[model samples]
Target: MNFREFASKNVHRNIKAYFAYFFSSSISAALLFSFTMIIFHPDFVKVDLPQYLIKALNVTTIIAYLFLFFFVFYSVSVFLKSRYKEFGILYIIGASRKQIQRMISIENIIISSVSAIVGIIVGIVFSKILLAASGKLLGFNALGFYMPVKAMIITFVAFVMIGIVISIFCSFIIKEDMVLKLLKGTKKPKAEPKASSILVIICITLLTVGYYLSITSSTKTLTNRIIPVTLMVVVATYLLFSQLSVFTIKLLKKNRNLYMKKTTVLWVSNLLYKIKDNTRMFFLITITSTIALTSIGSVYAYWRDKEDQINRDFPQAFFLSDIYDNKSKVDSKAGFIEDSLINQGIEYNKINEELKFVIPDGGKDNVVIIKEDIYKKLISMLSLNANFSKEDESLISNHKVKNIVLDNVEIEVVLKSDRGLIPTFYGEVYVVKNDIYEKITGVRGYFGAFNVENYQDTLNICNDYYNNFGYEKEDKYHNNLLKSRILRSTKVAYGVILFSAIFIGLIFFVTTGSFLYNKCYMDVIEDKKKYRQLNKIGLTYKEIKRVLNIEIGVLFLLPYIIAVIHFFFAISSLRYAFKLEIKVAAFRVIVIMLIAQIIYFLIIKKRYLLEIKKSLI
Candidate 1:
């Protein structure tokens, strides 16, 4: 047969082995194309996406591209490893290394090329649905889908280049192995796997430290602690998979009854080899899954808390301020704003408070005291009930109040607002009885809040007004402007992040499942002869299935179970950092992961049993 025919036939013969890799490559390409298409879509490009968000999208796409390259390279390397005996035979039959290289290259080129085309086709077919879903996620109703030729071209070229690089790299790697080594397909024998006691202790210590730091560190310290904590957790994960798992198996083996139970001996004996060989794969899967889960979950949590965040950041629709040299000027400006809103057919609620900065009788610090009536008006507007029996006072300050002892001015704090109306002020604000408030006279100021109907629409007009006539040091807290800008930018950024995360997360999850499938198939290949002997020795098909179930179930659940643990701690750390309740998001992430795991388990179980059944026949 010609070289092309030989290569094509080989691929067709090993279609089962190649299916998962091909499927993943196709999915990777499709996801890449879908994201790139967003960048190139006519409608998307025309919209006013924030510069930061644009850069973020570009960065995310580039990262996904890099990830795909490595993913494809790794998959190809693994595929070639399984074909070592085939390569060895060709060499024995006088096929030159160069010829073998050409075959490998051709095979990869054909598979990747076909998968790439299929991926692009799939991406095109689903682009509209993806775009609409993304639109809903970002709260942008105007997003529409269109096929972008530019995106297709970019994705095609990129994957083709990746395939070529992978082929070349594989060719070099395959040429290094000797014919005998390739033919035997055997690895060097090693001492039995054992866990070190000291290493075990270290593993526990590191994991403990990582989890503690993650959970307890305040938001301010979280950034500083991330590097050290992450390093600890990574090292711990590696050690846990490598040493701790083997050690646990050894400990379990010590219990004679448990070790000798039905199929337990068979599966346990095999598990040592499985864990020893697959430690790195399990570690990789766990870490990557942890990252994906945390990224998607945390971003969703942030999006879910957007309203509270905005209200905390910008509490009022407008903060009109001026020196109280003349109440008339303040009134005139306030009136102008009111008249402007009226002329434009906008409804508004106004809160005018004349403020005086005063030094209390025994206190050295300056405090702003608002009139009782004004405070009552503000409190009523917020729909909160407060009773002031002459001496009852409320303090509005971001700082925590402990007994309110400032230079012997011992006023009990009846109520405290941690995040007060003003964003910038650090000093104390007292809403006191009119009698006490009038007792002190100092520098005075005027504060007016104009809360318009349809805050977002009025915000645009306010911005225009400010640009045309606002003054410096005169603070304007446009709630709608600040809130809308923050929400839009945040939603766009986090929405894109969450989307990419979920996409890549699924890819990683499926890749891990495929890894498990491949491992199980390889085990079946090795165990078939043993199974034939066992069949003669009275091992039934049912017994064989029971063994396979335990073996495959353990293999499948190990990485995922560990990943769920990692996700729990990671999400907990984020809760402390964001200081937002994230139970709902965390629960959703867990449910989705569980569902995905169950589906993957069913597929793997079905295929693994089929393989076992084949061995019996």
Candidate 2:
């Protein structure tokens, strides 16, 4: 056959090889495109977002893509290995090495092209769905809508360039096969875990220390040591897998019941065989699982850090400030009118007050409003760690308390504020004050939240407050406050869910994909047992089918259950590592994660079972 004819024939006859190669290339192409689109987006130029955010995202995307690049490349190698025997047969059939190489090259190229087309289509759908979801999450249904054309073009160009180059590389690599090597195939040495016990010990020790370091991480010292401990943790996890799989399997086997129960005996036996016989697959699965978990943990931590910021920084639910240079047409006293509609149990603290304005002659920086002697005690309460002298201390004790205002602002700016001090009056320990304080204060804004009767009431009140917010004439102190709070909370929820889902996806990608590749690889080595023999001796094809289902089900479930438990301990370790002192809201987050995991598990399980059925046939 000519090269084209050979490729078409080979691709049709060995459809699995074609598929493996295609999917590998497709994922690589999609990733490259995703990175290119996210990093070089033109719309970022027009958006009113920060430059640092774009730069950060660019760096993050590059790092992520690099990881994915290696991921795709490794998967490609697996596909190549799976085709070893077929290539060997082609070489033995009086085909010159040059002719064989030409045929193989074209086959790979075709496979890549087919896979890339499918991946691009899938990626576009994913991107569009993400955009719609993000828009809803952000509560501005109009904003951040994805235009796929630009992204598609960027992804297409990126993947095509990379795919073409990688295709050539794969073709060239395949040419290294001698007929004998293909016939026997490349045999990896079984894992010698007993011989590597010392290395395993070191890896385990290092991992333990790394975990300890993370757990003991002080929030105060978190800035300096985060990188080293995290890196060590990652390295140790992979190393542990490399050096300890044999040791672990042996330990598990010691439990006779575990090794003997129903399908458990078969699973354990098979797993041991897998770990020893398929060292490369074992390594890939471990590496992929660790990466998936770590990525989720890291991203969730980044997002959860915001919780501390929000809970500590903002003391008020409603903060309405005076907008500059605008005359009020409506009575600002409309708040009191609104208050009258509520029952006695509802406490409406209407705080209408303006602080004396103090600024350096030119309005260059944040203008600090100078507080009156009357307001000094109130100011101290807003900023934590605020200490006033003995004179101010006496004033606090002697000053009468009719109302308390929870003035929440940008914490740092609040501390360094440099407004002129309002003029002092002698010993005027005033009793009750009226609306005069509100006018003099310019009613810059109200800073208060409702202490509602119940939790649902709290949500209703907060939502109402969030909705009523608008720019007032004298209000300019901290408008970024609203967006900051909303974004912080939204990002926490988003990052956790997003990271978990992506991690699970990666696990499926690495794991189920690895299992498929392994089966293909073994089919070459295992053909000595004829398909006819496999059907003999009480083992029907249907029995093989049932066994395949059980094996796959075990393969997916065992690691997953372990992963969830490990993740809990892992996050608990996170709190200890960061020294973030609080009882974690773990139950709620876990519930959400479990729900998502169940959905993802079912989808992947269904697809995997379908794929397994195909692999068997």
Candidate 3:
């Protein structure tokens, strides 16, 4: 009679509602918590570069919201279907429409709120996990994980708001007549005619063209990206699902053995029915699987690239450079370093560390503005452009123009040798090469590069350097952001993305795969009558399993094959999105994805077969 009693009853009635809540809240919390730790990283405070990266990472919140929103929205629909009959009951009970609406509203709001709270707690836990993971990744001591209460509030507020909004919208469904509907199941909508074969072929052709553009695109120039590929994949994915399911069913109908069998006709009919029955699920599976494969693969690729890059940054065993904030100090530091190297029993075969200035040539598309201080430091550590131009002066300015970067910048430099000097000239600066040091801008800077004899020894030297000059030891944070590309960086960037995607994809494949599994198992469950009738005539369990296996294989493998092919071309279409130069990257990406795909298929297939065996038993 009262609100509390009504609420308790509603809660008891809807278990799926709770699951929806749990999934939504948990996913949201995880992303928010992880992001919070990433944004104001304690480790990054000392490392100036990470601080900037942290800032950029925060901007990706929109992406998280989009994902969570889809998850929660779709879950509500699924939950509703399970409880639709209950609404019919309420309608039959002679409850006033207003009363029914009130009850449903209370139920939805309560479920959403409870779910959001649980999600935040789970998120808090996941935050700790992510922080710990990041610590290992950066090779830093792990801090005791703690939630940013403020972040908790923000996540809590946002998801709660989303829940309330979704619930309020859901409440309106109560207005539908519920009583008479209780006796009859919801009416099935009439199916549309099958897509025209010619139209389907035309679409396939167009999708092929889209894919061709992606694979052929030069990735080096940022001319390509994920957008086109993603779109192409989506369109192709849906079309393939529609076309393949229909065409295959029609093909099987033509086979005498397949069509003439008693229940085989029914099974075939069911397959055609499901092609219509599972349209929404098909769309979801297609997209989710594609994203998953790409995401998991991308993360590993990105990480590997970073590792390769760090290794390539220094190839020798041991090397050191001077520490200074200006040209004069830099020259003196070079002397200090040279003396230290000699005193330390180190031999240098060639000039290991060279200095140059990276000046920004501003442009619209550039996301990373490689500033003077950062570039100077990078160039000093490795051999860079010797030419300087008036553009190089922009490095001294607070806002450097990135468009001009790698453009018309003049450089001047001199090469020092025991017997002679070689001078090089560029736009503005004159070369004073052939000395103990190379000067860039004659300004105070802490940027330099090095190559060493051995990696481990160099690591130790770096440790010592960090002990002296690392984040905590440094008095202030420098805002120099320099970006570099590793040959494998693209793969790595996509690897982590691929990992999350695959994690979700695997979940989706398995979950939806269940429906297919169930269709096979349903025969076993309902076989008593059908078998009794058949036995009166003639049949065996072995024959039954054989027939069932064929049916299940067609059902399971058909969409999967279509999805796999769609994903391949879809991935190819991504060429323009990533601006990937070196088409070889796509090949490498493909190989990695294939290896992972095999691994994933093996796992899911094992689960599917287990279900089949369980059903047969």
Deviation in angstroms for 533 in model 1? 2.8
- Put down candidate 3 lDDT per residue, 525-602, tens digits, no spaces: 344455546545666555555555555555555555555565555554343444223244445655664565455445
Better of 1 and 3 by TM-score: 1
Stretches > 4 Å off in candidate 1 = 187-190, 320-346, 352-377, 387-394, 402-415, 423-448, 452-485
For candidate 3, the per-residue lDDT at 541 reads 55
- Hey, what RMSD does candidate 3 come out at? 10.1
lDDT of 2 by residue, 1-617 (tens): 66688677877887654454455456655654444443334543444344555555555555555554555556556666767777788777776767755775666556655655766676666765644443443233422445557667655555455445555566665654466778876664555345277867877887677667656665455566667765665566555555576678778888997777655665566566554554555445544554455455545554555545344334333333333332132223235323532643454333334443322233333232323433453443333333333322212222222222223221111122221111111111221122333333322322222222222234443444445644333433423223233444555355434433453444345334545444443443453243336555454556555554565554444444434443544555556654443234444444554565455455544554455444445
User: lDDT for every model?
Assistant: 0.74, 0.47, 0.48
Give stretches of model 2 more than 4 Å off: 20-45, 94-98, 123-128, 137-147, 175-177, 186-195, 252-267, 277-280, 297-308, 314-376, 379-570, 577-617
Which residue pairs does candidate 1 place in steric collision?
none
TM-score for each candidate, following the candidate numbering: 0.86, 0.62, 0.61
Error of 3 at 524 (Å): 14
lDDT score of residue 582 within candidate 3? 22
On lDDT, the candidate that comes out on top is 1
Q: Highest TM-score, which number?
A: 1
Going through the candidates in the order shown, the clash numbers are: 0, 18, 68
RMSD of model 1 against the true structure: 4.3
